[model samples]
Target: MKKTLTGIFSGLAILIFILSIGLMISGTIALRRNEPVFVFGRAVAVVPTDSMVGNEPDSLDVNDMVIIRKATIDEVEIGDVIVFQGVNGSGNPILVIHRVVDIQDEGIITKGDNNSSIDQPSYQDYVSNDNFQGIFQTKITFLKPLSQMMSSSKSLIFGGLAIVLTIMLISEVIHLVRTYQDEKNEAIKKKHEEEIEALKEKQKQEIIEEILRDNQK
Candidate 1:
């Protein structure tokens, strides 16, 4: 029984370690990419005060985990769900996730298929063809709980993150220590040069002192 318990615990620990490493690698890659740094780089922006709620055409719950991405028209096709900065009553600098009603060179126009009137503005001037977050991939409420894993937890979340970071930091410190030892070894070779310079300076001072003494004599 003791051995069995030990095996189960060991397995759990191994899984946890793998998960820890996975999170670290993900963070490093996303930091390089310059996209938002999320646990999975995914978000659950609550439908705050109903501003964007019911604005999405396909449908989204009051609090939904929107899977937003970065992309352009080539990536986005007709009928794909997307989120963009819309100048609607969506509460200033609004992020609206609606269907692509039409696409234009200047910008793209979208509307909540559920809403009676189309949004008030166009993204032509605002959205550069150069850069765009692709669009919302899907609307599923099931993954909502997973988003909570992206947040504060004393034991599970923060502790796991801390353990992973500590490993990286320790590796860096070991590298620096090794480098310092190498530099120290090189300095040992310079000891003879330092001694030689000191001796030369001493001889010059002695010669000057001797000349002064001879003149006095």
Candidate 2:
């Protein structure tokens, strides 16, 4: 039972670790390609700028990780922070996250909580539901730094994971060998005891036969 539970937990840990690595790889690809990294219904992004930071409630800081979920036009109410694909000043597409301060006839107007003015009057100023990736669901304040470190030292992380898995595999093999040997030894002992009991029974029958022959003589 203990071994069974150990196997279960080990399997779960390995599965979780594999999933984390996959996410890291996918996130790296998405960031480089300027695409949204989606897991289930949510998108994950690492904050590269401090535009969202300031004296406001739930402000996001640089290097923070955020989870975003799909939002409908109706669901995008005032005060809701939204993520969208937009062109930056250099005319390159980028992901932007900001709060909705006003709903307009054409679309919604957004501004960074820390910025003094609304978004520059470009294609990015007015956002529609079609441009939306999602609304901010939650944030992981400390994960971005760790993720950056892991991404920078991928070789070291891979080596560590390999070593740990090798050790676990070796331990499992040793346990299996010891269990097999113990069972074999127990079987041999049982057989030896059975043989000795049979010998004693044969000797008792022989002695009784000898006593009967002497009485007849």
Per-candidate Cα lDDT values, in order, are 0.54, 0.72
Q: Candidate 2 at residue 194, lDDT?
A: 97
Q: What does candidate 1 score on TM? A: 0.41
TM-score of each: 0.41, 0.55
- Encode model 1's per-residue lDDT on 146-199: one tens digit a residue: 434533342443343344344544455557658987999889869978999999
Per-residue alpha-carbon lDDT of candidate 2 for residues 187-211, written as tens digits (9 for 90 to 100): 9999999999999999999999999
Looking at model 2, which ten-residue stretch has the lowest summed lDDT? 157-166
- Model 1 residue-pair collision total: 7
What's the lDDT for residue 72 in model 1? 57
Which runs of model 2 end up more than 4 angstroms from their true locations? Answer: 1-33, 123-125, 147-217
Which pairs clash (backbone N, Cα, C closer than 3 Å) in model 2?
none
Error of 2 at 202 (Å): 56
- As for candidate 1, its clashing pairs are 70-133, 70-134, 71-132, 71-133, 71-134, 106-124, 107-124
